[model samples]
Target chain A: MAQRTPLFEQHQAAGARIVDFAGWEMPVRYGSQIDEHHAVRRDAGMFDVSHMTVVDLAGDRVREYLQYLLANDVGRLRTAGKALYTCMLNEDGGVIDDLIVYFLDDTHYRVVVNAATRDKDLAWIGEHAKVFGVGVTERDDLAMIAVQGPQARERAVGCLPPAIADAARDLKPFSAAAHGEVFVGRTGYTGEDGFEIILPGDDAPALWQALSAAGVTPCGLGARDTLRLEAGLNLYGQDMDESTSPLESGLGWTIAWEPVDRDFIGRQALEQQKADGAPYRFTGLLLEGRGVLRAHQTVITVDGEEGEITSGTFSPTLERSIALARVPVGTGERCEVEIRGRRLPVRCVRPPFVRNGEIKINLD
Target chain B: MSDIPGDLRYTKSHEWVRQDDDDRVTVGITDHAQGALGELVYVELPEVGMELSAGDACAVVESVKAASDVYAPLEGVVVEVNDALADRPELVNEQPYDDGWIMRLEQVDEDELAGLLDADTYLETLEDE
Candidate 1:
C-alpha cells in the first residue's frame, strides 16, 4: 500500500503534480519548479519532507552507541541541541546512510535517516545498541517540514508556539531545540538558512497551511534535488552506495580520523584505502556547449579513463549544464562528455557547481 | 489546440509535416507531443545533409523527466535542422509548432505523404486515444 504524509490532503488542495517515489506518494511540483527553486534561493519556501524517517534513541548508553556506530565522532556534540552530520558504514567501509544525529540530552538523542534506508539503518543502530542498552524508537507520531531561505526563519518562527519562537530564533546552524512539544532544528538540505520543524503529525497540516498563507512557496522533491545538487550535496543512491566507500565518494572529510585509535564501523577498510591513496576523485563539470548533462552519461578524460556522471542537470541559476562525475584522481580542469555520440568539451572543477545562491564555478 | 490543422499531414508516430511549393517538406513534432513531454531541456537533432529513410530516427527531444525520439515522416536528405534548438531547446515546449520544427527534408516521396492521415483523420485518432 502507498503511504501518505500528514499533508497529503493539503497537497491535493493545491493542485500539485504527484508521483510515486520510493514507494511513497510525494509531490514532485506544486507549479513552476524553477519558481520554487528561486524562491528558496531568494525568499522562502517550505517542503513536506515528512516521508523521511525519524528515530529517537533514549537511555543511559545512547551517546556511547552512536560513537561506535557513526563514522564522524559524535563526542563533538557536547552541548544539548547540537546536531552532527555523519555516515554510518557497514563492516566493509561502504556507507549505510548519511544522516543527521541530534543530541537533545545525554539520554535523549534523535536520528533522522533516509526514508529508503530506514530498515537497514534501524537494524544497524539496534545491533550496536544491544550492548549499550539504548532503546531505539521510531518517531512515527512526528512529521517534519523544512522552511528554507533568507526569510525562512522569519516566517516559520512566527507560526510556531511562543515558547519555541525564542529558542528557535537563536538556533545556530546544525543545532536543534525543543519548546513545548515542537522540535525546531536549524538545519536544511537546500544549502539555505532555515529550520526543519518536527511537530505532532496531526498538527503538520495546519502548520504547513499556515506557512503557505505566509507567502513561503511550497516546493516539492524536484526542486529539492536541484537545490541540494546546486549546493554540492550528495544523494545517497547516486553519489554513494554500499559498494562505494567514503574516501572515493568525496565524503572523506566527513570521516573523523582524529585520535586514530577510535574504531568505528569500516575504519579498517578506510585505513587501507587511505594508504593506497585515491585513484579517482569525484568532480564537478560545466558544459561548455549546449546540452544538459544527465546521469549515466560517459565522461571522457584526457588520459582516456572512463568516468560516469552521477548527477547532472541544467542549473537554473547558472543557465548552463553542470554535473558531478567520478573521474581519475588526476583528471584536471578540462574534459569531454559524450552526448549522443558527440564529444562535447567541458570544464572540470571541485565538486559543487553552485552554493548559497552564487555560482561557484565560472561559466563565462 | 484544434486537434490538428487541416492543411498538414501527420505520421502515426505523431509528427506533422507540411509540403512546401518546391517539393521540400517541413517536419516537426505534434503539439500533443510537447505537452506530454513537459519542459524540454535538451535536443539531439540529426545533422544537415544526412540521408534518412522513412520512419528512421531523426531527432531526440529530451525533457527534464524523460527523453523521446522523433521519427522521419518520409525518406529524404536532411536539408537543415532547427539550429535555434541547440541554444534554446525549451523552444520545443514553448513554440512546438512553428519555430520549433525539427527538420526540413530536401526530397520526399509524394506517395509516402499521401498515405499519411489528413487533418480530420488525425484529430479523430487523437480523440480515440
Candidate 2:
C-alpha cells in the first residue's frame, strides 16, 4: 500500500489515473498527459505537489548550519523570503539531493526536498543539525499546490486570502511570503511563471477545486516530469544521486566558492575535482533521428568515449526527443545514442530547451 | 472496463487480432494496453515486407513515459503497416481498435487463431492482473 495526499479523493473525482510514485499513490494524469503538458506551457495548470517534504530550521545557528550543510551558501539570501536552490552533498562530493531553501529570517528558514529522498534527507539534516542544536521540524501538517504557466499567478491568487494574495502578487522570483496560516512561494520547477502555495492540509481539497473552478487545469506527475525535462530541470534520482558529484551533474554553478574559508561539506572534493579537471561534461542531446531518447542509453562521442543519458523525454514543446547526458570532457558537437542496438545521430548543445513560454534552443 | 470486441482474438501480451480474410489478420494493441501506456508519441512499425515468427518482437510503441515492445502473435509476412502512426501516434490512444490498427499480417495459420483468448477470457486475464 502507498501513502496518499490530502487531495487523493479530489484526484479520483477528477478521473485521474493513479500510479505508485516514491511510495505514494499519486495521479499520473487526469486525462491525456500530453494535453496537460501543453496546458502548463500555454496557460494555467495546477499540480498537487504535497508529497514533497518541507523542513523548517529554527535556531540562532541556522544560517551557520546551512552554510556548512549545503553547497550553495544561504548567506546570499540577505533579505527575508528570498530562496536559493542548492545541493546537499556527501563528504566525498556526491550529490545527496538538490533542494530549495527559503530564508525567512536569521533563525527561522524553510527547506523543501524531493519526495523520494525525504527519509534520507531528513536523517542527514537531523544528524548534522545536532551539532548546531538547530530545531528541525517537518511540516507534514501542510499541503502544497503549484499553479504554473502564463496566467498561473493571477488565477492562483484569486483562491487565496486577500492579504496573502496581495503579498503573493508582490513576490519576486525565488521569493516566498507568509500571511496568517498560508505560505506562498513564487517558485516552481516547470520553468514557467507560477506560485507554490503551502496551506493547512485540510484546506487542500477546497483549494484544488477552487483552482479548477478558476480554469486552472489539474495536472499530474506525468506532465510535471515532461515540463521539468523541457525546462532542463534535473530529476533527483534520475539526473543525479548519491553516486554522482555536482560538478559532473551540471550543478557546479550552485556551489558558492567565494569567501573561500566557509568550508562547506564536499567543498574540498569539489575543489580537488575542479583542479584535476572534471572527467565528465554534462550537456544536452537532441535526437536528429526518429525514436525516443531514454535514460540508460549509451552515448558514444565521435572520439569513441562513451556516456550515459541521465534523463530523456519527447519534448511536447519542441516535438522532438531531448536528453541530458554526461559525456567525456572535450566531446564535440556530435554523438550517437545507442537505441535498441541502433546508433542514432544526435547534436550536443546547451540545455534549457524551453523557458518562459519560448523556445530557448534552436530546433533546426 | 476496456472495450473488448467479441469477434476479435487477443494474445496474453495485450494485442488484439481481427481476421480480415482467410490468411490476412489485422493487429493492434488492445484498448486496455493503450490505456495503460498513456498517450503515445511514436511508433516503430515493421516494414510491409518483413517476415515475422510467432512471439517475435517486431514493432515498438513509444509513449511519453516509456517504450514498450509490440510482439507478433503468429508467424506471418507483414502486408501493411499503419503509416498514419508515423506522424500521429496518439491514434493508438484515441482509437486503438479501429484507426490505431498497427499492422496486417498475411499467411497466418487460421487454426492458430483459435489458441488466442476471446473477449471474455481476455477480460478475465486482465482482472487477474
Candidate 3:
C-alpha cells in the first residue's frame, strides 16, 4: 500500500490522474499536463507537494551540525528565516540528498528534503547528528504546497492568514518566515516568483480549495517535472544520486569551499577530486530537429566523447526538446544524441531554457 | 470510459479501424488510448510506402509523460500517413476517430478485419484491462 498525502482526497475530487511515485500515491495530472505547465509559466498554479519531508532540528549545536553534514556552509545564514540550499554528502563526496535549510534561531532550524529520499535522508542525518547531540524531528504532521507563476505570489497571498500573508509578502527570495504554525518560504523549483507554504496537515484541503477559488490553478507532478526541468532544477534521483558528485552535476557553485579549516562531510574527497580536475562537465542539450530527448540516451560530442542525458523533456515554454547531460570536459557547442538509433544534431548550451515566462537561452 | 463507435473495429492495443471501401482501411488510436497518452507533443508517423505485418510497431505517439508505439492491426503496405499530425499532434487527443486518424493501409486481408473486435467486445476488453 502506498502512502497518501493530506491532499489526496482533494486531488481525486479534481479528477486528477493518480499514479504511484516513490512509495506514495500522488497526482500526475489533473487534465492536460501541457496546460498545467503553461499555467505556471503564464499565470498561477499550485502543487500539493506534501510528500516532501520536513525535519526540524533543535540543539545548541544544530548550526554546527548542519555546517559539518552539508557540502554548502550554513554559516552563511546570518538572519533568522534565511535559507540556504545545500547538499548532504557521504564521506566519498557523493551526494546523499540536496535540501534547503532555514535558520529560525541559533538552536532551531528547519530542512525540507525530497520525498523519495525520506528514509535514507532521515537515517543519515540522524546517525551523523548523534555526535553533535542535535534533536532531529521529522514533521510528518505538516504539509507543503508550492504556488508558482508570474501571478502566483499575488493570488496565493490573498488566501493566507492576514498576518502570515503580510509577512510572507515581504519575504525576499530564498528566505522564509513562520507565523504560528504556518511557514512560508519565498522559494520554488519553478524559475518563477512564488511561495512554498508549510502548514498543519489538516488545514491543507481548505487552503488548497481557497487557492483554487483565488484563481491559482491546481497542478500536479507532471507539470512540476516539466516546470523544474525548464527552470534547470535537478531532480535528485534522475539528475544525481549516491554514485555521483555535485562537482560533475552542475552544482559546483553550491559547494562552500571557504573556511579552509572546516572539515565538512566529503570535504577531503571533493577537494581531491577538484585538485585532480573534474573530468565531466554538466551541460544542457537542445534538439535541433524533431523527436524528444529522453534519459539514458547516448550523446556523442564532436570530439567523440561519449556522454549520457540525465533528464530530458519537451519544454512547453520553448516548444522544443531539452535535456541535462553529463559529458566529457571540453565538450564543445555541438553534439549528436542517439534517439531511436538515429544520431540527431543538438546544440550544447546552458540550462534555464525559460524563466519568468521569458525565454532565457538563445533558441537560434 | 471512451467513445467506441459501433460501426468501427478495435484491437486490444487500443487502435480503432475503419474499413474505407473495398480493401483499404483507415487506422487511429482509440479515445481511451489518447486519454491515457495525455496531450501529445510529437507524432512519429510511418513512411507512406512502408510495409508492415500485424503487430509490427508502426508509428509513435509521444506525450509529455512517455512515448507509445502504434502497432499495425493487420499486415498491409502503408498508403498514407496523417501529415496534419506533424504540426498539430494534439489532433489525436481532440479527435482520435476523425481528423486524428494516423494512417491508411492497403492490401489488408478482409479476414483480419473480421478478426478485429467490434464496439461491444472492445468495451469489454477495456473493462478487463
Candidate 1 residue B125 Cα shift, in angstroms, is 8.1
lDDT at position A23, candidate 2: 92
Q: Which stretches of candidate 3 lie over 4 Å from their true place?
A: none
**In terms of DockQ, which candidate is strongest?**
2
lDDT at position A103, candidate 2:
98
Weakest 10 consecutive residues of candidate 1 chain A by summed lDDT: A350-359
- Global local distance difference test of model 3: 0.94
Q: Name the candidate, 1 or 3, with the larger TM-score value.
A: 3
Off by over 4 Å in 2: none
Query: What digit string (tens of lDDT, one per residue) describes model 1 on residues A89-191?
Result: 9988999999999998889899999988988888888888888999989988899999999899999888988888999989898999997569999999988
Using all chains and alpha carbons, the TM-scores for the candidates as numbered come to 0.92, 0.98, 0.98
Pairs clashing within candidate 3: none
In terms of lDDT, which candidate is stronger, 1 or 3?
3
Off by over 4 Å in 1: B1-15, B18-24, B109-129
Error of 3 at A162 (Å): 2.0
